[model samples]
Target: SNNDYNYTVDLSDKSLILISINYTVSETLEIPSTYLGRQVKNLSSSIFVTTDTSNVKTLILPDSLTTLDNTNIKPIYTLENLVIGNGITEIPDSFANYMNNLENVKLGNNVTKIGKNAFCGCARLKEIKVSDSVKYIDDYAFIGCSFNKVLIGKNVEYIGDEAFGYFDYILSNKGNSNILNPYYVINGYSSTAAEKYAKENGIKFIDLNNQPADTEQTYTYINDLVAGDINLDNKVDVNDVTLLQNYSACNVEFNDFQYKNSAVTHYITSITINNVTEIQRYLSGYIDTLEIYSVG
Candidate 1:
């Protein structure tokens, strides 16, 4: 009576199952749709922990699968390409930890939450496109990645704490210069908040606010601040030197001296005269003053 009787009653009311299979699978794996007459709805923890699927490069999750908890599953150390089905809503933490060669990821449209440290330490990952269904991103989701670009979808509303922390590390770290200008395009309808966040965190924000409007041009302006010319009359000559000497000796006060749009409120440090003959005359007068002081 193993195949007959009330097997249907037991199978229909079951929510979880733990089964062990002894089979050797090669490089690529496709989870079969029908397993023991019931649809493979979810994966149990540590299901592939001891399985020798080290050579597997691509994993195709079943469409009916709604949850995947990596608490017991062995890390996919050799997986470079991963394809998640659209039915998945959450990606487990530490999902991409040991995937050193993983360079590209395509997330499903039904995904709503990305676990913390889900994609951390993926140094070779260059690009990622989050689907429109994503609503929350946990901390350090993309930490320590060398990716220079990230394209967020339109429906993404919240970028969690330290969600872009790795981007700040790439920009501030003096040791690594290869991670330059990583973000080129961010596609979303709520781009204003994204732009503000980018600018506040030192990332260049390309204003994509216009649909039919053309891109705005950027320009740089330079202004120099120089001292010694109190009045800023353009020439550092005898008149300027006399003015400086009088100001320093307290004979004349800077009641109205203003330069470069700011009030000259401090004492002048040094004066540079442009005329050679005037400099010679000023030195002779200084020598005469010293001689007089020595004799007196």
Candidate 2:
């Protein structure tokens, strides 16, 4: 670690291991993905074991990071911010447990598992999100937390004992089950584990797919009368011929909006394509149309 540098890293095989940090570092620390011309990949458990928290607060990991210890967040008790990169695959056991100062967190997109006791005893943990890739939440994962809202992704299939429990009675009064309410309004896909847990345990639930599906639009096939309109420009020209020749004869595609707009342009500019489910030949009356105007 250099005296002039605020962050410290150990590189091996082109991957990064966040070794440590200087006590005098600023409040927010952003770890870089590249160091000494190599890619950074991992952050060990001991990176923040000895750092001072007087001024240190936010920690932002790089998107290239694939391995990290979720439980060994930091020894900084006063810190309040953390950001997980999308490269992370899981949240290990006892992650950030008892870290009452941590107010918010957004789990990475690749995270597939939430281990046991991951966020237990975090009294101030109000905002949290589980990615759509997550498949399971282990037992006691969020015990004693204060998050008021949560979203369970569609892939989640299991909810372990007391995974989101806060009190003993919240789960069950007659059965041995520890299926406590999540204490939050849960939004997830209908008939999923998320919906089942919310319903069986009397927690609030919102179906993710309850909203109407996108409206399907259809377009009419208007066979153009102009020759060499391969780029869908209304008139025949050398530009169309050149474009057609370069790509082994152009197979141009245009949506309703693009075709309609380009027909009105003094000359066609930018074109956008979308939702082409079926292929129709341009040769209904195109044979006669091409003969009427020779390609330029």
Candidate 3:
């Protein structure tokens, strides 16, 4: 009765069709290319009920597949690799939950929408490449992935709330000190909102409006000096003193000048003059030693 049952029904004029399959074992399954007459457009609900998931690695969806909304089709946990065909446009919510070992995901070129929490909790996922055809990415689509980087394609327009929530978590955690902070380089996004968000959350945002022509542009700060060395010569000395002297004179013509040169020397002279009284007490001792040496 299982083999003879019809798995396909014509729905050319209708909008939807429902089919049922009853299986009692877990094993390698190659879904038939065509069931009855109409092409197998979707995997029926509760089609695979076996607990042993060792043999399942690849799932090839038919071109006619436009939806995979079956609640009982939870075989995604057993699948290490999933290839969605060009016909599918959306992935259901929480479709990839608990799939800790899924490493790579190749989204179809025609897919337009990804549901919320679609790929949450994929801890071992290394990369996600959304195609140019994707227009909307739902909230938390990649919430808790351990991937170090994320590459958003050009066609994406909207990033929902908490889409990068896990990234913030990783940065705040004490264990991830060695991981470099993620830098987000977006071409066309909300400049005001993105700037505000990055500032508040300590995330790095790079504006790519006009990137440097080559690597030489990165060397523009060869002369920038902080507190340690003001002259940019990698050492502090008399030249620094000269700079401070010129600065205190209020000479507006020169750009590099320091006020410490004049102020420090005046302070030292005042200190020496104030200690002249103490120097008088040791002067007689020095004269006595000179007289004894002359007599000898």
TM, every model = 0.58, 0.61, 0.53
The TM-score leader among the candidates is 2
**Residue-wise lDDT of candidate 1 within 19-137, one digit each (tens)?**
33356667776665455666666665555665676887777776666676733333557777777777789888876664677766777779988888788767666666776688777
Which candidate gets the maximum lDDT versus the true structure? 2
Candidate 1, residue 156: Cα displacement in angstroms equals 1.2
Scored against the true structure, residue 218 in model 1 reaches a CA lDDT of 20
Model 3, CA-based lDDT:
0.47
How are the candidates ranked when ordered by lDDT, highest leading? 2, 1, 3
What Cα-based lDDT does every candidate model obtain?
0.50, 0.57, 0.47
Off by over 4 Å in 3: 1-33, 50-53, 71-73, 165-296
Ranking by TM-score: 2, 1, 3
TM-score of 3: 0.53
Worst 10 residues of 2 by lDDT: 272-281
Model 2: lDDT to the true structure? 0.57
How many residue-pair clashes does candidate 2 contain? 1
Predict model 1's lDDT versus the native: 0.50
- Give the per-residue lDDT of model 2 (tens digit) for 1-296: 55322333553454546566554668886777776656667765666675655676787877888866632675867668888888888878877887868876777889888888887767676656676799889877876565545767788898776565343222111122332332346778887788887776666677879853221221122223233354555764455444444433235543222233222222222221210100111233323333211111
